[model samples]
Target chain A: MAKRVGMEVSIAVAEAVKLADADVIAAYPITPQTHIVEHLSELVADGELDAAYIPVESEHSAMSSCIGSSAAGARTFTATSSQGLALMNEMIYIAPVLRTPIVLAIANRALSAPINIWNDHSDIMSVRDTGWLSIFAENGQEALDLTLASFRIAEDPAVCLPISMNIDGFTLSHFIEPILMPEKAEVDKFLPPYKPQLWLDIKNPISIGLLGGPECYTEARKATDDALWGAKRVVIKAFDEFNQVFGRQYHVVETYRHEDAETIIVSMGSISETAMTAIDEMRDQGQKIGLVRLRLWRPFPEEEFLAAVSKAKNLAVIDRHMVMGCSSGPVGLEVKSLVYNSGLRPGISNFLLGLGGRDVTRDDFKYIHEKATSGQVQARCEIVGVFE
Target chain B: MTKPTVDAMAKVGDLPMGFTAKPGSTVAFKTGDWRSVRPVLDREKCIYCGFCYFYCPDGVYQDMGKDEKYYKADLDFCKGCGICAHECPKKAITMTLEEV
Candidate 1:
């Protein structure tokens, strides 16, 4: 029988990584994300999980070591939060450039200026162009499920790029939630033993990370881009297969009561859950408002997002962090870019809210819907809940 | 017999997967044409200490048996980096301009 337990999401992520049977884990301790690596270390020490738990000195070293281990034909994993992810930025770029299939669990935290340890999308947004497959988890169960799915997707021969699974720090990471943990046998059936197509073996030598001249640089970059796009298929397939085994379905862009709704609120991470409640509350009052949550952030899920929101007259995007100086947040910017190109002119209103762990209540969602529908939102985006 | 520069296993053209074969697979793509300065090893002054063999980044020096007497640089893979010539203990190696 599968085990169901109430545990912290970080601990659950650690359990999920262990369940994936990762060969190596390299990570450093960072707030909200510390429990993940801590638990993973315990599993390694207790001999419950047979893997190398590399307690690297820094996040940079953590990622570098993960790259080395993954390149050496090992299924590797690592976890980090805001500043930790920022430190690992260079290696994050290299991981995809080398096509190393290392799974990174990011407990998304706010970036430092005042050095706050709160949940936000700033960390992951900072490395958006790093060419890794990115996914967001709405709750503990999705975090656990997606962590397992990351390994399956990243290591696929067709999609040998690194993947980052984002779990909102403090909010999702610290909460003790009841989750159905998959049996090792079932996980084993869902995910096969990883056999790397390309590896650094001494016996059969192969040159990797060769210097590409002006002639080959474009092709090299093109190859990485194409690999990420192709990985979308493998990602969708992995989620589908996971659903088949676990009986919980997931999609790139998951909608909640979106049909027949004239207006929809768009968001990602745990905030989507709040939006769901708000949407349901509004729906009961005979408001045609629904929620559209983006689960897959990277590869952008353009087609699905467009299809999901095409019928809606208004799109209110709730971004946890803003792009600063830009009219909207990164999600809003990308959504606009996608919508603009498709020639679907919806009155898109972007709301920057819940930054630095601020509470975004159900009332806030209702207010956003009102502002968006009444055309009171400024030019493109508005900083909601800020006292002027 | 002169072997072809690119072997069957060496990946040529655009690598869509970024998958490369074995370490030093660039041996198949000879860098001899990249030479501006070529190292000339004098057998008379050479002590066969294998410093050139040890120092050359490109694995240009080919060791013929264990003897110090028959060490020769394979021009096919040598990019004329001259680290071998600079590291020669006995001053027996000279970096000569290539006849390009």
Candidate 2:
């Protein structure tokens, strides 16, 4: 119980990769994401872990190599930042269509115009429609834990989907902190070396990528579609197993004081910790407030989301990146879609805050919550944090 | 980039031609040889994106001769065989395996 040491989130993520026991680590160098692969590189080099480390030429090839390794039935891992993730965009759809449970760590960074290296949801949001399940981590501890859990959730027999776990770029990964590293024996009992039932093998000699006519295209898509929707239950089962082993409680939608509160702030990734601090401050000042931290974004927790938001009169959902024409932010777009789709009566508002690694303070939360409760949805889409 | 294995590419099977009213088809509705060429679109849940145009060989489908509501293959010229179905990215076209 006392072997705890100061570990950077990036290093913790590397340790989690060891626990996940990934068979292939395909990567290209990119900012904020470089150290994770570097640490993983040392592990593989030192013969501490048995795996193939392919130093791909580009982010596109990093994804391409992982796709091949995954198709050949290997548990694959990789890490990339803004441009690197954007470069592998097309393969994003292909990876899940093949139903490979490849786990990628996104060092959340801003998409370039001015070429910023700051933390933002821009990189992840761009690929939101690619059918990969995305999980967010609030700190280094969760950054380590969620990455391991992601492999389990993604590779579940019922789910078989690709997963992306986002850890804030300069914020969490580089920030040094104390972490309890689990023993290899415990991780071994929890996760087994991946044995794929279906794979691209020469001996089996079966065909994939066969042409399907209108007569059969629907069924292929249907299988992937149904599998994703079914993943909600799959994730819960995997999470339950994970919780029992690790002593951590995770739900589709994690609530803080939502049971008795009149107002709720919905968020994802590292901002949840800041939101909690804000909640504490607001509560001390006699505001009946709470927080809902969303962990999984794909297979968008429909019934659970309704149940969570049903009691709240006022809700403000924060999105780190805008969804362009259709909506302002990705999470904001999702929350609105769920609200409109289910016909739930919560007064949901969209808040586009903490973008490009802007440190969101307690004061920012107080202002957004107050405006949201006063029935101020200030845009054609809900763009929170604007000043006159 | 290394080329995709010619052997792997060679193994993709030819599409079936003309239909049979078999009791064992997974699809509920199948066109059985009446129209000479059967077009099967799987709507198990169709996103309805069209990819069949690029796939058809033999110039069987006239892009536009009369009406273009839906594309059709010239059956008289076609051997009643379905290569279009095999090449279709969406798998929306099916030709029943029939004797030429």
User: What does candidate 2's lDDT look like per residue over A1-388, in tens digits?
Assistant: 2147799899899989987888999999898999999999999999987899999999999999988888788999999999999999988877776778899999999998878898989999899878788888888878887888888887776677789999989888798988878877766666766877457766644344444556544555565666677788878877787778777767888888888788999988887888899999999988989998888777788788878888888888888886667655777777877788887677777788777777888888998888888976655455445565
lDDT of 1 by residue, A105-181 (tens): 99999999878999888999999998899999999999999999999999998899999999999899999999998
Deviating ranges (above 4 Å) for candidate 1: B1-16, B32-100
Best by lDDT: 1
Clash pairs detected, candidate 1: A205-B22, A205-B23, A206-B21, A206-B22, A206-B23, A207-B22
What does the lDDT read for residue A301 in candidate 1? 88
Q: With candidate 2 superimposed using the best TM-score fit, by how many Å does residue A228's alpha carbon deviate from the native? A: 1.1
Q: What lDDT is reached at residue B50 by model 1?
A: 87
Interface RMSD of each: 5.4, 13.4
Q: What is the DockQ score of candidate 2, to 2 decimals?
A: 0.03
Candidate 2's displacement at residue A95, Å, is: 0.8
Model 2 chain A weakest 10-residue run by lDDT: A204-213
lDDT of 2 at A219: 50
